[model samples]
Target: MSEALQILQKYWKHDRFRPLQQEIIDSVLSGQDTFALMPTGGGKSICFQIPAMVNKGICLVISPLIALMKDQVANLQKRDIKAIALTGGIKSNEMIDLLDNCQFGNYKFLYLSPERLQSDWILDRIKNLPINLIAIDEAHCVSQWGHDFRPAYLKISGLKDHFPNVPFLALTATATPKAKEEIITELGLHNPKLFQKSFARKNIAYMVFETDDKLFRIEQILKKNPQSSIIYVRNRKSCLEISTQLRYLGFKATFYHGGLSSKEKDKNMLLWMQDEVQVIVATNAFGMGIDKSNVKTVIHIQLPENLENYYQEAGRSGRNGDKAFAVLLTNPSDIAQTENQFINILPDKAFLNSIYIKLCNYFQIAYGEGINEQFSFNLNAFCLKYKFPVLKTYNAMQFLDRQGVITLSQEFSEKITLQFIIPSKEVIRYTSLNPHDEEILLAILRTYPGIYEMQTAFNLPLIAKKSNHPETQIYAVLQKLKEKGIIDYHSRNNDSTLIFNEIREDERTINRVAKYLENQNTLKKEQFKSVLKYIKEDKVCKSKLILNYFGEKTTEDCGICSYCITKKNKKTNTIPLSKEILLIITNEELNSREIQNRINNKSDDVIFAIQQLLENEKIILKPNNKYILKL
Candidate 1:
């Protein structure tokens, strides 16, 4: 057996690789820079992972999502693999220790976000490590044309200069031809071998419904498909509203959003993943790196910002190759809302400048200063102080990030850590004096072995369950313990981290990337138009439209999509519409409008038959817009 295959089976417990995965792995193993375009759930991680294991030195993975990095690291550790993720908000000493571990501690995989590349200290440290390969996940973000563009991705190419011999692997689930070319050019890949899996998903039946009553339609769909499902909304308010309504209707449902605490998010996600909940209504924040294979349905309550986003979200269904449904519920108003939300309200250059200036003021940084400085940013406080809209301010910050002016790390869940300040024996004596807090403290000590040595994540729910106490009581006990100098605790539920990429500047900085901003706006307009076209288009198969948008040409229609199904139903109605119209006209010399009103068929079918009759001289149209049978 091949070394890659052996490692895959041993660690991942898979006998064979998915389509195109082994080939990609071979390219990496052969020391060739490779670009891989795999769909969601295509096992993209294994392509780089198996080869990294087969090779000698450590693999450096540059990813965009901290949650994804943490999850993958946890999973790898569970399989007895040494993996570590260096994300934002870590202390300087902790980061030094992590880097030291990566260099000396036989760690096989080291995952870090692209934004970290801005730190010269980090780069200097990385240059000393025995790095074998560099893998970039969500590689499309390096391209200007990609949906999720990040400026830090551009800095990834510098690694090539640092480690000239190490091969590079770029992987993403959504990328167009334009984005693909830009990724290669931006990353400076040398003679890269490219592997692209077909984007067609045969098991997913794409359905779009234009209904006046969306709630009723959703209910109908949920009733029909009573399996694990995900319903995506546009905002947090809707997430709560829909989940509440579903529960009221006696369906097992939960809600998730970025506003939820990490503990709540994990608990809710665990419930759904364990089959304790039938549905999860959430915003787009819910399903990144989620590995649920049995999700039978994925429904979108509104049109997404772009086809790439929609495709990725819809592709979440049917991952196990079982028959599943991807349904989109929208109306005329939704199309308008999509345009307004994504395009019309987009931050202009002036607004972007205002936001940037306000951000500097909020952080109390003067002009031409604050380079490489990081701050714990409170987004709500900033918005409230400046009286700016939250969403628009956030978008402006993202634009600044794309221009390399700043790095925004919005980690929804912070990692809370606690360390015992007093000796274990002293803690035992103190807890004995305060008998009410004894159970919780003992639970914490029993659950986490190194709590006295180093700070660990604070899991209130787990501690509460173990101590047979409510979460409120557990929190009270922890607070009391902290007040008495028994332990030191830091909570990660609030605040985002921001790093100034360069010296603070005024509006001229915006001018430096003016052309890039213009291109982004143009891309946004085109993406909105494409989404609108997908919704209004009735002559083409829905699946075909999506495939074409992704640069895939298909002459054969997915015969099961909503469009094809509607057309098939029209053809199989078993009654000839022309004859039906003629029969109605024979009884009375009626106008075309009257004839249509008298028929029991669809209005479009009736109008089509009338036009055919008029063309064939079977019926005559009078000047008063009336139709009569010719004798």
Candidate 2:
């Protein structure tokens, strides 16, 4: 067996590599630059990890997501591999100690966000490490043509000058041919070995349904599948609402979003991962660096802003290779909703400048000063003070974040989590006994729908507002209840820290990056056009359309997608039985349309009955090509 195979077996316990994984690993091992354009679940991490293991030195990985960096580091640590990630919230002393550990402690993998490269001290220290391979995940971020372009990623090529001999491997789940080329050019990959797995996922049947009633379609899909699933929404409110609705309809579901405290996220993710919960409804922040092989379906009720995100989110399903589904439920209003959410709210130069100035003033930064200054920015308070629209102001702040003018550490947020320990009757008795606390307890009851059933995160300020009291008073009441063993509760402020990356230059800051920002805006518009076209165009195969979008060409249609199913139904004598019925049909409902619409799904029974009836001549095909049943 090859040494790479040996490493894979030792750590990952896989007998062999997936298609193209070995080749990419071999290319990097041979000291050749490699570009891997694999799908989301195609196991891209092992390509760099195994090579780094085969060699003696630590592998340097630059990623765009802090959550993914931390996740990879934790996974590697669980495997007894010494790895370090320099994500947000690390103090300077802690960063120095981590760097020292990497320099002398023989760590195998070091993952850091590309934004960290802006620190000269970090770059200088990293240049001295015994780096063997450079892995750039999310390589599309380096290309301005890419859907998620980050300006800091462009600075990664400078490392090439530092580590002249170390080979580079770039990986991205979704990238266009143009973006691929730009990634290669921007990173200065020299005669890179390219390995691209086909964008087609044969086991996944992509389905798109045009329905005004999305919740009905979601219910229908879940009832048919009834397995582990993820429902992606565009907003946090929708996540909670959908999860509650699914639970009301008798499905075990939980909600996750960025606003959830770390403990809440971990608890909810664990419940879903362990199959204690059958479904997890969440926003886009839920699925990075987490893989569950048994997820049978991924439902997107809201049309994603772009197809790249949709493909990645939908690809989370069916990883176990049994037949799975990727369903997209869209209504006519979704287009306008998408545009207004993503495009119309996009910040222009004027908005960007105004927002930047407002931020500097909000933090009390002096003109031409405030370089390297950081502040704990309460987004709600800032928006309220300025009377700026929340979403638009947040978008502008994100624009500034992307342009490197400010570093917004949104990951550092907190929320109140609580649940009633006593039964409803006991809680009511306690509330009556404690009349002074009754108002706050009642406010909690009115604010949270399932406080007695399960623990969940809540908006503390909102609860306070509901109780017509100060937030401190609400916190004190919850604490008193906890002490009395009436309820379990905790609360923390939800504040995002903002670090000013550049000196306070009001208008020039926005002007300096106006062209780049405008170009990105245009790219977003173009991306939405493709998204709209893909959902609206039912003539082309959905799988083929997605495949072609990533520059892969194939002549044959995937015969399992929604388009293929619809095309098959167009032929003669194809009974329009619901997929729910195709799975199982009971004896009593064999000839009943109403029951057939809600039949049990057991393949063998249905197939066996068909064979028995055909052989006994109880069923016959007539000359008109209709199946006639003679009892």
Candidate 3:
């Protein structure tokens, strides 16, 4: 216990542990398999880190995201703690060097992706290391029932063969009852001590408002809170539009979305984190690995596809225990819109089968081959070539990825590989004859050391800079050389990469997973139904509804939610709806929709209040369609 505490303070500078963190750590230290379900900001990393730090040998950490693994490794390195992550796209010699470092560098942590476990050579090297503990981050990925299911995570249990005596720790921020059971069974945890913190964030008042104008309601919420806030939309266009509108409305605002470059994301994120921007409008891509404790509000202008995602994103606020708000804004149109966006576009089983066969043929995979083969993919081009619906086909691909038929990465990048197929002396003779290509060939040879011996990844811009030519001309020269068989060259501007983990059985492969694919489509429909039910059942407490969804039954209603407040106000005969409308139009006039937008309550309630005011002669409707106080 003392050692754990000392390590925590030394590396993390934390005086004590959060709730359930220490208990989970103690179980791990006692050589017990441990599973923990904590919230997003609950410090799940420290649970594995402290116990692993207390142990003698290295702790092997398995996670899903390459970016997150690199982020953690960098953070550990900053604190002078020894850690390394075997992330993707490394050369063979680099992999060997990294593995050798893990063997003899006294590194306390070794992080890797679950897909990396499929390689026998890497696993063999890992088996030789003196690993004391195995920690799986985002452990929910192992279960099919989990929201972000990854089939590769199912392979993690195979590690038990290499380290029979070592304990394992599995950590996740969100999981359902079925997911929890499957995660335990899938990981083969031996009588694991389970710890689950309550999903309810008492300080966060979950509220939903059906309004006609979402933008105006955003203004009202921000004006009331007037602190750091996040508004989550569903698309890049909305991100830019909303952020622009907010800035026009006199707020320090920024935007983030998937389309933004890495530099843009970092700059915008820094602005918000440093309080230079008080609000950021973004899509779902902005919040991962963010732990801004004092975020006063998280507003979802679009309906969340599922409660699991909703709960995780909404829980980002009020991490410091101050009062906060989780606001979901929806109109009647949003229900059908959400359904069309998420549910209707889901691919059926037949579509899935067709898509699978097309993908195999597209990649030119032979029957019973192509295991672990990867290709730079362009989704739009593939869909166009096959005459498939882009959204439905993309959804089908996601299903295949989760089912482990293929691993998909949607990172927009350009890949260019080159190697000299002919002898270097022959290439030199040709370059001397063609004076225009001589400088480019010399630049490639000088800048890239071993292109002749290996298929080297190179940048066209760098070669152009070295040769003092335009990038297009450099590419043209390379293409001409490839035409003459001087080099083997390949380049692509790709939207994604597809890596197959199975042989190309075509129909047989699709038949194997067909039932599960249908079941997944059914499951998605049920999830969307649950989300709609949550939205319509406004009479129930928001917090209690969320708790019940996760199978956590709580009898008490959280008094901060919209239902509770409305109930309390009904008993007092003063719903504040009329009061707010009157106050806003007292000095300046606003129409019915504008009044409803100004007040973050039910439009029905707002309309009823406006009617009562009209009947009482307290307010008058002008012929111009505006409401005004009758002085």
Strongest candidate by lDDT = 3
TM-score of each: 0.78, 0.83, 0.80
* Tens digit per residue, CA lDDT, model 3, 1-631: 4989999888888899899998999999999999999978898999998898898999999998777898789889999999999876776689999999999999999999887888889999999999999999999889878777777798899988879799989999988899999999999899999999999899999888765567877887898889999999997657877887899999999999765667888899999999999999998887877889899999999999888889989988999999999999876678889988998898887898899888989989888999889898877657756878877998899888767788888663335768898888898789879997888889999987767765666666567767888878988998998899988998856458788989888878888878777766776777788888887885799999999989899999999987777676566443476777889998997877778668887655675577567757988877565789999
Query: What is the Cα-based TM-score of model 3?
Result: 0.80
Q: Estimate, for each residue in 554-576, the C-alpha lDDT of model 2 and write its tens digit.
A: 88899988788767745633233
Judging by lDDT, tell me the better candidate of 2 and 3. Answer: 3
Candidate 1 vs candidate 2, TM-score winner: 2
- The per-model lDDT (C-alpha) reads 0.84, 0.84, 0.85
Model 2, position 56, has a per-residue lDDT of 97
Count steric clashes of candidate 3: 0
Q: Which stretches of candidate 2 lie over 4 Å from their true place?
A: 411-490, 572-631
For model 1 the local lDDT of residue 277 reads 92
Local distance difference test, candidate 2: 0.84
- Mind giving the per-residue lDDT tens digits that candidate 1 earns over 1-631? 9988899889999899989998999999889999999988898899888888998889999998888999899999999999999976687799999999999999999999887887789999999998988999999899989988877899999899989999999999999899999999999999999999888999899988764456766776788889999999998657877887888888999989886777989999999999999999989887888879999999999998998988888998999989899999875467667766787767888888889888888888999998878988766556756878767787888788766688787653424568898988998899889888888888999998867765565656567677989978977877887888888987665567898888877877888876777778888888888888887787899989988887899999998887887677565543478888888877677764566567787644565566456657888765444667877
Best by TM-score: 2
